[model samples]
Target chain A: MTALYQQSLEGLTRLRGIAGAMVVSADDGLVVAESLMEGIPGDAVAALAASLMRRMGTAVSAAGFTPPSFMHLQAARGALLVVPAGPDILLIAIGDRHINLGLARIEMLQAVEQLG
Target chain B: MRALEPWVEQPLMTFLTESEARLTLLMTSAGQVVAQHGFTRAVDIMSAAALGAAILSSTEEMARVLGVRPFRALSHQGESHGIFLSAFETPRGRWIGLVVYGQDTSLGLVRLFFDRMVDELMAGVPAEGGPKQVLAQNFESELHSSLRALFGR
Candidate 1:
């Protein structure tokens, strides 16, 4: 599990415009593993990103809408991309505006499936 | 259909209206029906629940540690809009969520909703002891591991 998580992070780094990546447990919203940039606060990002993921899930439920299979939070500084690896697993990516979003998403989807 | 006041109260909701507010589905955190807007009527309810469940569990856990509060996600579906917002309690599991779906829903708007919804839920509920110390410790470690993976350092 740990090795695979590490590989996922490295894969994120190899992507263009991406700042970093992390493997988080959607069940607990805690970072299981990570790969980040210099001086960047990896812990805070993971925590906050997990928090955001939870928030997105709840919002989907309350409005009488179908639950979200995955969440994609995009910001000006960069984008927070989340995908479910399995029942309790998630793959998150933080990237700059220039990142090839469609490509990154495809890569992440493939990576997450591999974890599954 | 109803007065837009309730819907307009949330910026995220409005954003969904402007966006792909044509095809979408709505639901509650507990797998109940609150509303369902536009879609092919062939939407996958299970997928929606999976998405909501993942988010709900995480936020509830975070609220416990941050000493803020808990919230739930509220969804609003439009033709092209897709939004999900969850509000939570500080330490003891009390929150709400509001999600909106549409084409014009910007990430900034979604974030704005997140900030406001947290504030709203926190204010609405009474304070409580944050997550247990032991649980917090484990969560902290988990956070570290995940972040390292995210950064790929």
Candidate 2:
């Protein structure tokens, strides 16, 4: 499982400013596996990403909309992008302020499919 | 910092009374809550207010960078429960509303009535004492007071 995740996210980190990545349990926001570098707090990102995913999932349903295939969070300093990997897991990418989400999103979807 | 006007409250109440929505809250884009319905605890409102504001802000920024339009509404559906967080503008300022519903109502219904509710809200807003352009010198204290009021702390 670790090998699979490691192989899955290796290509994603090559993108500019994406310092870290992880797979987290959407239920409790705990990390399953992570590939991280300095300056990115993986645990906090996992927690927020998991919590946000759970909320977005329900909010989508409550509004009569399709559940989002992915989520992207941007802050002044950095960004965290989340995409559903499976029913209960989320793949999170932590990037710097300049991380390009358009390309990053495409790359993450590929990583998610490859992980499957 | 401001309360939901009585005009706004009437329609919000009516919307809740008519729909199966379990809870609803009107709060600022920055997370300061104005008015709420169906919540008993301050902490719950505080949490909802904070989370709703954060989600709206993040998604709005994400849309700008991703080169897509910002999401007008967000939802999460479980087997029997759901929530909707959406943003609207009023004469006062930008506001975010979060609603909760269960099996008694459907998201389809929620979506339908929510539009009306928003329209009522937008029409009801008054052009007085709207939020300020510059942060107040005592913004910290004001914020704390507002939080205390919102959370009953």
Candidate 3:
């Protein structure tokens, strides 16, 4: 793994309840690097999250809003959080319901800065 | 979009919706068209199918000479557009897909959805008989008829 992705994923995985963190291509949804729990399907997560992000970006812009910087999808079992690292890259986190959103957000922002 | 085979329509449509591909062609490895989308003329479809099949065949032969397995897929990216070409197995036969995408979509997304579509197509294909044969004697007529069906001309 590249230092940028390894550092980002490693930092995100340290948080409690966080199942995985991945550096994904926003354009293609391919995982660049990941620190995923044993059962987590990183490829599916990256692809679906990137697809959702693209759809949401389109909808947001069509509603006269600027492109979104961050997005969250909370499910019954887990949650997905995405933040743009650059025009073509994304930082994504998968976590349980008890995960700390505030801390995760801060860590993700720092990771994005490192990516820059 | 139009499909010479009815079963191909739904899978092709689903692929288009998910991948956001601007143009797509699904054909046999032998260059016989089974379905197509976003093509305005018969000549374009025929040319693309022939070229795609030729490219895939030549690449496969090259891989053989190099003692490597044939490539799973090929892609070319440009400033404004990108093309993805891949071959997959089906109950019917091996099929090729040629996709053209723009800024709104990425190759990763296309490939992901394409894999799903292949699975769907494999399941959805009827198992009543062996694969259809495209004989040389009827090739031109079949091509013209398929084109007419696609364009309603």
* Most lDDT-accurate candidate: 3
Candidate 1: docking tier: incorrect
Which runs in model 3 stand beyond 4 Å of their true positions? A1-4, A55-67, B131-145, B148-153
Badly placed stretches (over 4 Å) of model 2 are A1-116, B1-4, B133-144, B147-153
Per-residue lDDT over B20-49 for candidate 3, one digit per residue giving the tens place of the 0 to 100 score:
999999987645678999998899987887
lDDT scores in order: 0.56, 0.76, 0.87
lDDT value, candidate 1, whole model = 0.56
Give the C-alpha miss distance for residue B74 in model 2, angstroms. 0.5
Error of 1 at A28 (Å): 3.1
Model 1, runs deviating above 4 Å: B1-153
lDDT of 3 at A66: 91
lDDT of 1 by residue, B1-153 (tens): 111123313433443443323322333233332233442222243344346655767876887988875653444444556556554444434323444433333333444445554554345433544433324335434333323332332
lDDT tens digits, residues B14-80, model 2? 6786556888887666555677777887667767776777788899999999999999888888877
What is the full ranking by lDDT, best candidate first? 3, 2, 1
Consecutive 10-residue window with the lowest summed lDDT within model 2 chain A: A39-48
Interface RMSD of each: 8.7, 12.5, 1.7
Ordered from best to worst TM-score, the candidate numbers read: 3, 2, 1
lDDT of 2 by residue, A1-116 (tens): 88989877767788998998898877646688888887676666676677667777888999999878888888999888999998878899999999988999999999888776
- Candidate achieving higher TM-score, 2 or 3: 3
Q: What TM-score is obtained by chain A of candidate 2?
A: 0.93
